[model samples]
Each structure stands twice: as structure tokens, then as C-alpha cells.
Target: MSDIDLSEAVWWKSRQSAVNGNCVEVARLPGQKLAVRDSKDRSGPVLIFSGSEWAAFVAGVKGGDFDL
Candidate 1:
């Protein structure tokens, strides 16, 4: 992730986020990569994923694979 340039990355949070601002922000980076960071800590560590990895995660989410 350090090899990627995020200086101009545009980040946005989901509309379903809590009004208190407890949410994560996602940014689409170059080369089909995605970056995620905590909204409360914009300068904190970020999680980066490949396009395929993101797609699988989203599919899992929609499939309720993450449900407790």
C-alpha cells in the first residue's frame, strides 16, 4: 500500500453510516485497487485491497457471510 500514491485520492463513506460519524471511508485507487480507512482517524492506517479481493468481500457482504 505504501507504493501507491494517495495524495489525490477521493474518499467517501457509505450513506448508511451513523450520524455520529462512526464509519469507514473508501477510496478507489489506480490499478483497480481500493483503500479503506476509519472515518474517525483519517490519518490512521489504511487497508488496501485488489479489485478481485474487494469484489469477493462485497459478494460475501451481500450474501450475509459476515452476519453474526
Candidate 2:
């Protein structure tokens, strides 16, 4: 899918996020795309991803694929 306007997207951080505000916010874009941005920098850059890519990333997180 092509780029979609994100100016109206409502970003939300995980409920499990800590109080330090060191987290990312996620927004659901049109055409099943997802956008992620740093909570500490709301006006900063955003990383966009397709539905499948986001799903895989979520799966990885659930499976501890990125555990240190």
C-alpha cells in the first residue's frame, strides 16, 4: 500500500508502559498499515509498517525473539 495521511491518527502507548515515558506509541493507519513513534518525541519521525510486517513483529515480541 502507498503512504497514507497520519495527521489524524490517534497514537496510543501500551497500558503496561512504565511511568518514565520511555516507550513507543502506535497508531492504526488506513489500509491496514501501522505507524510507530517514540512517545518521548511526538513530533519526531515515525516508522510505518504493513499489516503482515506488524503482525510478524508482534509475534516475535510474544515469542521473545528479541529478548536480550
lDDT per residue as tens, model 2, 1-68: 33578889999998999899999999998889899999999988899999999999999999999999
| Total residue pair clashes for candidate 2 | 0
TM-score of each: 0.95, 0.92
Best by TM-score: 1
Model 1 error, position 67 (Å): 0.4
**Tens-digit lDDT string for candidate 1 (1-68):** 57898889999998899999899999999999999999999999999999999999999999999999
- Model 1 bad stretches (over 4 Å): none
How does each model score on lDDT? 0.94, 0.92
* TM match of model 1 to true structure: 0.95
Error of 2 at 58 (Å): 0.6
CA shift of 56, model 2, Å: 0.4
Q: Which stretches of candidate 2 lie over 4 Å from their true place?
A: 1-3
